[model samples]
Target: MITEKFRRQLRTEAKLWQTEGLIDDYLYQQLSERYQFDALEKTASSRFITILISLGGILLGLGIITFVSANWQQWSREVKALLLLTLFIGVNTSGFYFWRQQNTLSNTTNKKQKLGYGLLIFGALILGANIALMAQMFHIGGSPYGLYIVWGLGVLVMAYSLQLASLGVMAILLIGLGYLMGLSAVFYPGEFSWLQFIIEYMSLVAVLLFIPLAYWCNSRIIFFLATLIILLALEISLFRIFDFLNHGLWGAIALTLPPALLWGYDDIILPKVNSRIFQAFTRNLAIWYLSIGFFFLSFRAIWQDFILVNYSEISSEIHWLTLVEVLVFVGLTIWEWLCLARPNKRDAQSWRLDLVSGVILSFIVGTAILCFWHLSINEIPEIATFIINIEMFLLAAGLIRIGLARGIRGTFWGGLVLLTLQIVSRTFEYNTGLLLKSFVFILCGVGVIAAGLWYERHLSLEEVRK
Candidate 1:
């Protein structure tokens, strides 16, 4: 993530220090060697080449389309079909030829490999176009979701056969689009009944298919996208199966699953997981979800909405999906706890991190119990606001504590930002006058600045001591 310019500046500083005898030449060499400065420049060059190749491919595709359009009037149906099939096969064959050469040819250079990659990318696009053109030529009916489903499956086959990460990503996107289209059709008024358009089931199928593909590909981008699709599918299933927009259910999910992932991802899941891509995805995804979800819950209006909306209409219907989600959550929670507790008492702190996860686990478990109790008694929503406020503050405080202990600036700033946002939001929500609001804003800004300075000074002192 570090930029080339920054790396260059760092190297220059190291040279200056060496020349001035502030640091030894050996130390300077170590500092210079610590960062892969060449990587940033190489990545930049690769991206530029990719962009240029993409543009050329686009222009070439357009040229072919123009020629085809000009000759369309004279071509018969059979001719058109034959032409489309020929182009599809030809593009893919050419791309594969180049890609194979790039990998196998001993004399092939980086430029040749990039060209191969570009051709493959262009071929993938052509494959999609070919599918749509064929579908149109045959007069295929029904929702566009059907077309997407077919196209996605086609790309998925290619992805699996070729073991291409880009193709895997494309397949996921296409399938997600199809799933969304299907969901829309199922809910479309007067056009289709729920049973008539069982599109949501495709989401489950997608999860089953893509999760394995992600692991197989060992691509973090693909894995992350798959995970998101799974989450979306699960949420949609919750909405459809429950037949109510019960905030309590969502709240329970938000509280338990994200925190479990955030706190136990590295300690529990990383040890068991083989794929570096999956581990990275889990850690980052958990961090973002927990931060954003907790911030959203800090607002009082959210709790008010949960209290105001009634779920009586679908209260009698048994939601099997809810049970599934709960079971999965519980399973993950138990697994995390077991992993955290497996070590001896002597290594407990190393595993548990000052009982931080223990506290988060306790809170999530308590929230889950309340969620189930509220399902029956529905009393928690009435007092949910106070509980959520307390949770938000505590979560923020915990993050700050962890950040300070670990010396992670990002986490520390994230905690400060969340705390500041909570305070600012509550301040403005009240019917305070302009003068009071101005004073409050000033107070917040000054307090934040002072705290930041103090933390920076503390870090500097620690560095000096080291």
Candidate 2:
């Protein structure tokens, strides 16, 4: 899809070309027709008006809510119930009517459509209020998260029916909030509620509920969040189970597995289903995971602490649920490797490993070896720390290299910052003299400036070549 900025730029360039006599009036008219130059102003004005209408609607809704709350205690149960039902039905009916009217009337401005969308969102909020007030009137008691879960599920149903991206996002947030709030009850002794069941299997539930919605809405944000929820849930489950085992094993799995899964998602999972829409998002997430995970692992203290932990007395029995989860992910990871090894049909050359993939694979292997050594010999080698530190540096350099090659400033700066942080951290972590620390800091500053200048030069050269 063409962005508004691009369209505006194109329009300006087309006008310049026409003025310079590079294109005839007929060609200019064709360009105008193709890009719909006349509609740009309309779109901008409609957007401004929509924002005003939405803000006004919000204020009006807030005023009505406050007024009702002020006199809510004076009303009887029957009156309260009737008012709640009427408000819910009336707001939703009006929103639907306006939404349909705008669609049916092509001559109408988008202001009505925007108003309809805002009202629908407001109706969703009112649904939650209605749920809360009705529960109070009926004297129903339960965990607060239970209420959020029900409210979120109701919103999710609306989202599915309407296929509205905003409502889908709202539902995800509500459900995620409920899950977070209910985590304490999951660990501590509490009264049983059906919501607890949902909380326990939230990872699977998020996948089942949000993944399809993401595809249905064609929303990258929803897909990213849903995947994040799944990864977090899996990590939490792993840590809980491995709290009894050697921390090294679970930590390695937690740090490596998610990124590996994300990096290979397109090849291993998506290809079978014939979809690549989310490939870029998954790879970006993988890079983020690796960068952060490697930074933490770069510290010597982390490895030393892992080595010092006493795991002999811990119970060997693993929870069945966590075990199954680990097994499934491990199985998928192995399958991904197999797929990567297979030759591509479109290309004669075998699948070549990219720098990022190589770095990730190396880190995983290094971590696995370190954990295994500690497990079998009951001692972590000093070389293990060195290996991890080297991996971190390599990852940083790799990111910078990839970024410069691709002309992505964020990736380049991300690597530069990571490299600088590692240097600064090491300088502070060790008992170095102040003079040496100051010298290192100065060197880092100079190095960063040099790298930035060189990157800019490289970008300029590439643009010239283009």
TM-score of 1: 0.73
Q: What is the lDDT of residue 135 in candidate 1?
A: 72
Error of 2 at 31 (Å): 10
What local lDDT does model 1 show for residue 72? 88
Off by over 4 Å in 1: 1-64, 102-109, 186-198, 244-255, 258-277, 307-354, 370-375, 378-382, 463-466
Highest-scoring model, TM-score: 2
lDDT of 2 by residue, 362-410 (tens): 7777777776665556665467667777877887888898898799998
How far residue 376's Cα lies from its native spot in candidate 2, in Å, is 4.9
Candidate 1: RMSD to truth: 7.3
Residue 195, candidate 2: C-alpha displacement in angstroms:
1.5
